[model samples]
Each structure stands twice: as structure tokens, then as C-alpha cells.
Target chain A: MNKSIGFLGPKGTFSHEAVEGYRSGQNKAYELKEYHSIKDVLCALKDGEVDEAIVPIENSLEGAVNVTLDVLAKEEDMFIVDEFIIPVNLNLVAKQGTKAEDIKVLMSHPQPLGQCRNYLNTNFPGVVQLEENSTSKAAQKVVDGDGTCAAITSKIAAKIYGLEVLETNIQDNENNHTRFVIIARSLKAKTGADKTSIVFSTDNKPGSLYRVLDIFSLWDINMTRIESRPSKSALGQYIFFVDIDGHIEDPDVHDALTMVKRKTSFYKFLGSYPAFAGKI
Target chain B: MNKSIGFLGPKGTFSHEAVEGYRSGQNKAYELKEYHSIKDVLCALKDGEVDEAIVPIENSLEGAVNVTLDVLAKEEDMFIVDEFIIPVNLNLVAKQGTKAEDIKVLMSHPQPLGQCRNYLNTNFPGVVQLEENSTSKAAQKVVDGDGTCAAITSKIAAKIYGLEVLETNIQDNENNHTRFVIIARSLKAKTGADKTSIVFSTDNKPGSLYRVLDIFSLWDINMTRIESRPSKSALGQYIFFVDIDGHIEDPDVHDALTMVKRKTSFYKFLGSYPAFAGKI
Candidate 1:
């Protein structure tokens, strides 16, 4: 489908990198739009400015990307259609001619900041820490300044801004990975390696939740992740985010999820998408 | 309580701030202890080096604090008791004589990097950004560097480091809050306004979770927060972390939670503690 995918930020952000994952010749044949923030991207999708949008849902290191989840929970019309697990290679990018020793500050998004800690402390010893919209924004700041400044961003950001890469793959852990989801106006195509996401609330009885989980066990479908967000109604109330292996079109998946819908006080289907986690 | 609390670092870290809220001075007296790293603090608590530990579970602006949560979820026997919400104020603290412009580098915990985005971009602009364990550790780094640098930290951290505050409450959103839970060697003594936390997994089926939620709705009892961590067992399984209003000792609350225990494949109570959120 030719969908204009909207994502958060300018040229060098990770979301931009993730959007790149979806753009095979098939997807790039369509238009692409970029926004400066998650809210803007969501708004663009809601306003019908884009056929679909990509927003980060979580990171292995950081956990839930709450912004997208919170909005999707409230935006009744939207649903996730596809997802990508991008292996993040955060770099320490700096303006041309800035020596590593000359750098006194390190700037990047907060998640990258934590992901790159061991290198910074051991190398710079005591440099200033700063924040930016995304790693690419940090690269832009360094490009604009052209001083001892440097930024931790994706290699793509460095290439985008014509900056030199001071360090490659500087994340504290080499296994850094981020998961992004593609959201659409409604459910569409399904890939078999697909995973279905749903939100449901269990009644507060002892065996109620156990009984709910039993359905999947009985059907023999696999659940990958399960998370809960506050129902925001009152104390003692919560809604859960769950992931199961297999597409909704698959009989077992559909049968199990349908059964859950009947018992839950609250329920919503997020989507069924192939788990496209590319290797680093 | 007479329990000694272990946090991430020596002084003025987010854990220290969380301690302020989690500590009720109930059992005996709560003593604050500092560690150089999160692992150390948790290991200490697990080893009986400390009575209880205060750890950050999630950040509202940035999302889940994975490092802490992952460890808590993986480690058995230990569980969450109660949680408190604390506002994260990232301040630019420098030596008494240093001016904002004179500040060459900024330092802070990696997490706060995003929280102070607009301020860092506008004021320090292109200055180097560095990351440390927490705002407190960042302050110590700046202090060690003499007048050459400044750190972004809690005001309390500034006092601990004997640094003057260059900027106050430098966070992106005024509503930025962090929810921290107290994990102890065993269950805790009850404080007024107590909240109960539990973990459970339901059979994977339709309406399984719904039946569980119905327990509380029927009781008119309120739940505060609910989160699910992958059971990371046997595959296709999950266990949820749920916090609810009223002490476990309260009849309705006890009844509701007790019934929920039977509905899932697994269930564990984190704890109950006084809701220490004092003033907004």
C-alpha cells in the first residue's frame, strides 16, 4: 500500500531510522512526511495528512514508549498494523575537526545518554551532559556550533548532517535494540510471522486472571509480552497490554482473542504485525 | 521503619529523593544509605546488607527505568511493597562564582538529559553534555573538576556537593514525576493511606482478565497502578504488577486481592505502604 508514513523529528532521529526499515521499494513508492514531535506525527495521522504513521513503542533498555501507547489507547480509530525491532547503533558524532580530547560536552537524547555511559565517564572524565529532541538534533547542535561539542546519535544522523563520526556504536551495551510499531487507520494486511497486541482488564477476583490466561494456554498460542497501564478511572483499576504470537487471521489467535473480548470489562485490539527485528 | 534504605549513589540521586517519599519512619527509623551503582544497592538489599531498598521503577516523561525493573522482576523472593511519586527537578549547579556562560560543560544523570532539553539548548546551547550515575554523581564530577564545569542535579544534590544553584527545576514538563517502589526483605509495617501491590498471571483466554478486574469493580475498591513484566518463563506467559488502594488488612481489599490470587497461573504481592505523596 502507498502510505505516507509520518514519524517524529527532522533528518537524523532514530524514528527516522526506524521509518527507513519500512521503506522497501514497495513502501517508498509512496510519500513520506516527518514531524518534530510524537504529538505532531500523531496529529498528522489523525488529520489524514498521512495514510499511516510510525511511532516507537518501547526499547529493550528503556521499556515502554508511553507517548504512543497513551495516545493510541485514547485514539479509538487507530491500530497497529506492523512493527520493527531496530538494532540501535548510537554513535558519538561531532562537527568536523573537533578532536575527541577537545570535546568537553556530550549531547544526545536521554535514552542514548544512559546507553552510552561507560564510554563517556571513562573517556571524557567530567564533561557536561545535555539533552536534545533526538540524537540527530544533537548532531545539528554540534554542527551549528563547530566547537568541542559532540553528540551521540545514529550513524545515519552523522551522514545526514555531513558530520564526522567520532565513535561508532558507542552504546554501553552492544545489544541495544528499540522496537517500533506502524499504526494505521484500521487493521489491514497480515504477515504470518505476525504478532497480535491487545489491551484487556481482568476482573479483580482470584481466579479471574488465571482463567483468562488459560484460554491462550488451551489454544496453544504464544504470548510475547504483557504490560498494564492504569485505567485512569479510579484506584484499583488497570488495563493490560498483551502480545501473542500469530496473526489475528490465524484461527487459534482469533479464537483466543475473541474469547478474551467476551470476559474482559475493557478490551481493545492494537494490531497484528510481523515482528521485523533486524539484526545488528 | 528502622530499616536502612540503600539508594543508587552517595547523595542527591533520584533514589535519595525517592527515599524521601518511601521512608515513613514507621517501624523504627529509616536510615538512608548510598551505593555507587543500582546493582550494588539492589545486591545489598538482597544480601540483607540493608532492610529495604528504594528504586525507581518508571519515569513519566521518559518511561520505565528498565535497569531497576528488570533486576527486580528477575530476582526471586524480593517483591515491591508500596510506591511513591517524586518530581524530578534537574537544576544547573555550578561553583558559587561560575556564571552560566562560563560553564563549559554540563553534567547530570543520563536520565535527566531529556528532562532539561529546552533549558540545555537555550542556555548552554552547544556546551558539552556528559552523563553520570545520577544528578548527585554528576554534581560530584563537577566538584572534582573545580570551576571548569557544572552539573545538572537536584537542589538537594547541590547542597550535598556544596555547589551553588545556577538554575532551578530545569525539566521539560512541570508535571514530570517518577514512581518509585520500596522493596524490602519482607512485608512492611502498615502506614495510613496504604496501597497494596501484587503480581499475577491469568490463563490465556478471552475474558480471563475481565473476570479478574470485576473483583475490584464489584468491591468498589480502587487500584493505583498496574504493570506487567514478561514472566520470562516457559514462553507465552506473563505476570502483572498491580497496586491497589486500602491495606491488605482491610476486609474488602483483602477479599478482592485474595480472590484474584486464584484466577491466574501465578500471583505475588509486592507490598503495602503509606501513600507518601505529600504535596504536589
Candidate 2:
């Protein structure tokens, strides 16, 4: 594998924070590659410009990131090889001397707005609002502020751009965690916390969904998450994405997948990688 | 039954559009009412405040509106009656003198971002962004801009505040459709194109999911959408909320539900409402 890995960014993003966490986890050698979009990063991987990409898969609060799921449903080769969670904390930042009281407009991404709806509705009652591309972009606007503006962003953003933090931990939920999945064209070294992700389309009959589950049950393999996304081909057919404990090599897990393959019209192993500890 | 209408605001919102849509479709004499939150609206119906409420279920470009699903999964004695696909045209509104060139910030709800992702990505590449509670709230901020700021909102919003339309049809997908459902505490007065929604939890055993589906097949019912949310109970168990063609009262749909009931540990009929009709 290459030493460099691409991450989603224009910098100072939670995606960037996830990249930071991944890099810090690697106590060995590596260089960081960054791209402004998930597609761009995924493309770079396709071109062999990078070894892998870290894509945000889900948030505890928002459920699955459908964009990643949609893209994954099509790409046949990429496997989700590792997973990580990043605790997000955003601040209201602005150009130096833009005091909280003087702030006339506040901006952030839509997800952050909903996450911090409680803060904005209560503390900043009747305050003028705005939306930006990414929280980091919001941070950039704070620097370019003609005054009268503030941004909901990470503290790292404020420090990186010389802005001041007006508020802290502004999201509505205290236990906010976003799950990120590391994807590559091939498998990783397989750590002990391993879990296999697979996608399949089953026949539209009674006990069809149950019959697939029977494999996991009989094998005593536990599933962590199961998501249903439209197959996009026909109206009624669907693709089920499930993550389960154990590796592809494990006899019980292999047997379950083989059994499911026999019963379902279609099935594919998405990846086998270490799962995050205890967020389920 | 009396109407228990719902809009997403303390008093004003685009949900009001869906409410008006429902009003126009039903007999003109049917009474209409409102609520502050979607959950509150569902509660009003469950606790018997009103018969049915209008709620936004999904958006064409944005996919599912997760909040509606989250609330519906838990609420008792309710199902979608009729679905309206409301065509949306977002206009960038500004205070009278604010020029498109002078506007430094743009604001709206997250819905608009994905709606107009391409437009913003191309034309407004570096503009400052902000997300608010609703397009109405964003309109309010632009009205109070007190600076060079604008909000992407509805034409009605511009009319309500006497603002200028700086931009129009700004959504990424020109055919932006928001599907709003008329929900009630009991089965609706069947309008012909009825669809039934139900949630069920089967034993967490292999073949359990498949067996449940065999019931749907036995009756030859068409399932349009199937989604899974966390059981939020013990781990490894999942509750599937399914939408299928035919009202529960129909012979085949009736037989399907009856057989499904026997196989699942639990089942609940959310409601039998008119099938969702995409924008006409």
C-alpha cells in the first residue's frame, strides 16, 4: 500500500479531524493527502494517487450518510477496511474584534444547524442566520468578514485562521459522534476488532428478510447495523447493507455469508475491517 | 373526522404550503388546524387532538426527511392518508437595495443546499454560507440583513416581506418535489389510491426476515419503500417499517397483514392513506 491517504477537506473540517485521528493512530510512517470532495478523493484512489480514503459513513444522530452509501452501492472494488469515530465540537468564530454581541449574522452547515438548533433557538433568539458550504468555509468567511458575521465551526478553524471563538460545544447533543469508514481498493491487515460489511438483494417473498437473518442467527454472528437503500433499478427491489462482528475468514461468518448467498438473489462482501469499539 | 393539520413553525412555514394543498384537495368544509412541531402534531393525533395532520415525508432530491420517519416509527394509530408532491421554486431574496454582486452571504435550510448543490457549486463558488430553521427564517434574516446578505427562499417569502428576488429556480434539481403526507389517528376515508404502512419486529433468528417477506409475496402486494431504524431495544434486533400498495381493508392486503401478524412478534398498522402521487 502507498504511504499517502486522501481525506475530505479544504481544511479545518470534522472530516479533517477524522483524518487527524487516523494519522495520530498510525504511530508509524505516512503522509497526508487531502481533497475537497469525497468523489475527488475516491477518484484519486482510482488513479493510484492515494492508498485509501476516509469517508464519513454515519452520525449517531443522523443515521447513515446516504451519499457514501449510494456511491458504494455502485463501486464494485472499494472495501470499507477500517472504521473510526470523531467527537465533534464546534465554536462560533469570527474575525478578531468581532465580539459576540456585535455579531449580526451567524452561519454554518445545515446538519450543524439542526444539531445546534437548541443553542440557536435559545441563546441567540431572533438572531439573523446564514448557511455555508462546509463549516471550514464558514470559518473562511469569518476571516473575510466585513464585520457583523460569525461562523459555527471547530476551534481548530479559529486558531488556523486567527479568528476568535465566541461560543463552545454548541451542538444540541452532548454525546455527538460521527462514524468514519476507511475505504480502499483492497483489504487491510485485519485488526482483531474486525467486522465484515456485505450488501445483498433478496427475493420479495414472505420470510425473505428473515431467511437472510437466519444465517447470522444460526452462525451466532452478531450484526451491528443494517441499512436499506433503494436499488435504483426497479421500484420494489432493495439493497441491504449490513455490518457484522467477525472477519471474512472466520468459519462461522463465512458459512453465514455463503448461506445468505444461496438464498438471496444477489450478495457481495463490501469489506472486512476492524469495527469501532462500543458505540452501538 | 376533523383535521389535525400541522405546519413546521411557531406560526409560519413552507409546511403551510402543504397544509393549504391539503385544504384545497379535501372538501372545502373540512376544518383545519396547526401545530408547532411534527412530533407534537403526531402526538396531537395519537392523544386524539385531531384526526389527521399534514407532514413532509420526503424530498425528491434530498431523499428521505429522516425526522418524519423517526417520529412516525414511534407514533401509534396513524398512517399517511394522501401524499402531495409540492413543486418548489427557490428565489434568492434580498433587502430592496442589496445587489446580487454586493451580497456577501446566502442563507437557507439544508434542503435548499442539496436542492441547489450544483448552482452554488458553480456560480456562487466562494460565497459565505448559512443554514437556518426554514427558508422562512432565512428570508427573515435577509429582510433584517442590515448588511449585504441574501437568503435563498420561496417567491412567497419575498412577497411576504416585500423583498427582491435576486435569483430563481436555484435548486440543483429543477424538479424539486417535496412529498407531504396527510396523517390521521385512524384509517382515512379511502380516496382510491391507498397505501398501507406498518412496522414489525420478528424474532432475531435466521430466516426471520425472509419469512416476513414471504407474506408480502403470497398476496402479490407491491412494496414501494422499506426502511430500517434501530429497534433501540436490545442489540441485534431490528424493526422494519414497510410501505406497500393497497389499503389494509382490501382483500389481498388484508390477507397479507393477517399472515404477517402471525409470523412477527409484533406489528402495527401506521395507517391506510392514499398512495403518494409525485408532483402533477
Candidate 3:
């Protein structure tokens, strides 16, 4: 039997697009499964229902997808095996015979609505904006609702729902993109160009986090990103998430992470994966 | 003439409660105004429509409130003059005659829905969950709908909407709290116990952020929190938000900030304000 992969989907979402892109780039064909939510996809992978799972980690316009980050940090044995970046191109989609001027209500997932804030404010200032669980769901709602309803969703979603594309590229920033990561129960073999992601919490003292960063600095490792999330233990306490260049197999990267593990009160090695190489 | 304050409100949301707490602690009574959104409240402060505005900056369980951070980063002349922390107490409320078992649909803002995830899953596994703009809005929706609808909202919202409490303290985490910041045109006077928040972007090079944090380490200042948001210009580029102990009036903080401004390509001084004193 071919290996199976899980993704958050109803067939027309960004995660589905990412899975298609991932499949096109791979040598072997894999069985694909669609889960309802990010957590369901990840949990399916953890429970051995699928060989791998793909979920979005961050978006240029919206910042980190907190649920993805939270799950990765909280779950054990979940490792990132690959990454892909997809440009987010939002469109005003509606039922057949509907024009842009006919849109009395706009609907989408909150993130897309926010990304297209400027466009919506200028084009349909008084239209009611509603939130759906996903962009695809928004498109589905438009299909089921009156012709006056429109959805801000991907081109694929509009196509799948047989909706007219009233307008395209409606996001405020043309450079908008989302980064998705493929996760599995075990680590992937390190490619020459790879990134290691980790989450850790330092002691409640002056310069504790600075010292952890100092290890990366001292080892001359280049960190691509850093973010902090509340630890949930208290208001002031936080857990730091950092992504650095180089694979764990590299001597310096290995040494730096080993030191980081020793220095922090809590540590979790998320994964070492081949970094997304394409430009936004 | 009395000064006026602005908040994101329908009179029963958490921001409304924060403003009420702030007003009671103030020396003089201020006229209160309710805005439909966080951005509107902050923009009103910048445009001189209100003397001050209060908005939630971070939550213990859900993490940083991105809209508040984005507005503070994008807008000029907004300063943090005060801070308040509110314990999040989620309740299941419905019409007077509604019973707990009668709730066919659960409604709330996304944050509250997330905070009460475990509670809802265990108690109302098959119930439909809906999202509203605010917890108060969810309460209002329940009142406007059939008795089978229930809202996961604050006590204030239940009282204002004249709903009966089906259950109380439904959030998974008892320690969940949200931190709200009061923004004004100018900085507040330095209290001995204070915090200065600043946002900056470091050069896209190895150890650039480390060197900036090194200054805080060198000055013996404690950083209470640090978070990064995408620059939106490109992937892997970020701007950081940091809160540190001490007022900007202190020699160490002033010198550290001056150096930070000189080191980074972009810098913004959010403000110096007395830190919230109460324990969570």
C-alpha cells in the first residue's frame, strides 16, 4: 500500500493546495486524506492513522498560526519533515450572475478578511463581513446563500464551488504568503540546506533568555526567526520558539542545541527539516 | 468639562470591564465612549477623539492580541500610559427558562471558544459551536435566538443580556487572564516600578538581535516579555516587541533605548508606564 498523508481540508483550502504541490515535487504517489481541523490532521498523524500531516505554520500578513505552534509545542514525537510556501491570493468570489456591486455581505475566515481589509473597506464599505471556519467553508456558504453574498477565498475554492471570481488579489499586501510544514512521527534525514526549530523556556531571572540566544550567537549560527508565546503558567512567563539555519547533524548546530537544552528549564526540539527554497 | 475614555465595547465585553476598573481607580470621573473595534478605539485616541483608550494587548492562554500589537506598531503618537490585568472567567449563559441540557448551540468569540475547548468537548461534545465578534455579542445573540442557544461569556454579559448562568468558570485553565494597556498621546510620569515597551527590527545578519539584547544584559535590565511579528515586506523578516523593567527616564533604560534606536533600521518607543501590580 502507498503511504498516506493527512491535511486540513474539504478539498479547496490552502492546505490542500500545499499537499498538491508537495505531491508534484515527490517521486512517489501518496494516498491523501482530508481532516476537518489542524488539530485533527496532526492528531491523526500522531495516532498512526497517516504517515505524514501537512499544516500551516505562519503567514506573512497574519503572523504565526497559534494552534499549529501550540500543538507542536505540546505534543511529543511530532517532527517536521519538510516545508512549503504558498502565495496567498485572495479573490472576491460569488454565485453565478452576481457582480461585484451586488455583494451585500462578504464572508471568509478572519485572517483573509483581515488581509483584504483595505480592499473591502474601499469596495464594499457597508457590507456585513462574516467569519467562517475556513476560506473553503466561506465559498461553500456563498454557494448556499443568496447571490448577494460573496466570499474572500482562494482561486481553487471559487473554482471548486463553481463561483464567479468578482475580483482577484484583494489582499492588502501583494507579498502575502503562508508557510506550511509537513510533520511525521520521526525525523527526516538532514538535507545539506536545512532548518532546525525548537521551543524552550528560560529561568525567571535577568538575562536568562539573552544567554540562550548567546549560545546561538557564540556558535555563529544564523537564526531565521524567533517568536514568543505565553507559557500559560503565568501572565509574565513565556516560551521562546526559534528557527535557525543548518541541520542538527552539523557539529555547530548540534553543540548549540545541546547547550540550549542544558540552559533552559524546559526544551522541545520541534524538528530539523529541509527549508522552503522558493521566493514569495 | 470631563475627559472622555474609549474602549472596544457593547458595555459587557472584557474591554468594558477593563475601562470600568480603570475609571474606578482614577482620581476623576471621565465620560466613557464605546467603539466597535480595537483599531477604532486606538485610532480615536490618536485622532484626539478621546482622552485615552484601553485595549487588550495579551492574553495568558491565547497569547499576544495581534491586532492591538499591529495598530500600536503602525500608528504614531500612541503611548502606553497604564496597564491592567483581568482574570478571564467564562460562563455558559442562556435565556431565563433555558436548562443546561437544552443548549443546542454554543456561541462565543474565538478566544473564549478556544479557552473553553476542553470544557465544551467534555460537556457538549456534539453541540454546534458558533463564533461572534465579542462575548457580549454572543450573549446578545442567545437572547435574540431560541432558548436552546447558550453563550460562553463573562458574568457582566450575562447580567446585561438578562441571561441565566447555566455554568460558571468553564475555561480549561483557571489562571487564564488578559492584559490590557491604556494608550494616550503622551507618556505617564515615572513610577519606581515601571515598564518600557519598544519595537525594533535588527539587521538581517547573524548575532544582530543578540547584540541588542546584550545591551539590556549589560545594563542589568530585566526583559519581562519579547515577541516577534512578521515585517510583512517579506518572509523570514521580523520586527520585535519587547517590554523591559524600568522607566525610560532611568539612565540605564534611556541609554539602552538610545543604543537600540541607533542599532536597528526601524525603532518605535511604545511608552513607559507603571506595570500592573496585582498577582495573577
lDDT of each: 0.74, 0.74, 0.89
For each candidate in turn, the interface RMSD (Å) is 6.7, 4.9, 1.4
Candidate 1 lDDT by residue in tens digits, A1-280: 6658898878778898778766762435756798866756887889999998988887665556666776777678888888776778888888887799899878887778767766776887667767665787788888888488999988888998999987798776666677788888888787667888888888866545555677787788765676666554433345668888889899888888999999888788888877764553
Q: What is the lDDT of residue A278 in candidate 1?
A: 55
Each model's total of backbone clashes: 69, 36, 0
Lowest summed lDDT across 10 adjacent residues in model 1 chain A is found at: A229-238
Residue pairs in clash, model 3: none
Better of 1 and 2 by DockQ: 2
Q: Candidate 2 vs candidate 3: which has greater DockQ?
A: 3
DockQ of the two-chain complex in candidate 1: 0.16
DockQ of each: 0.16, 0.26, 0.69
User: Could you arrange the candidates by TM-score from highest to lowest?
Assistant: 3, 2, 1
What are the per-residue Cα lDDT tens digits for candidate 3 across B1-280? 9989999888899988988988888899889999877777887898899999999999999898888999889888889999999898999899998888888888887788888877887898757676666888888889899789999889999999899988899998888999999999988898899999999999888888898999899899999899999888987789999999999999999999999999998999999999888666
Q: Which number leads on TM-score?
A: 3
Task: Please give, for residues B9-120, the per-residue lDDT of candidate 1 as tens digits.
Answer: 7667878877865665445567788887776688899999998888887666655566676576567778667667777777888888888778787877666875675677
What does the lDDT read for residue A145 in candidate 2?
A: 76
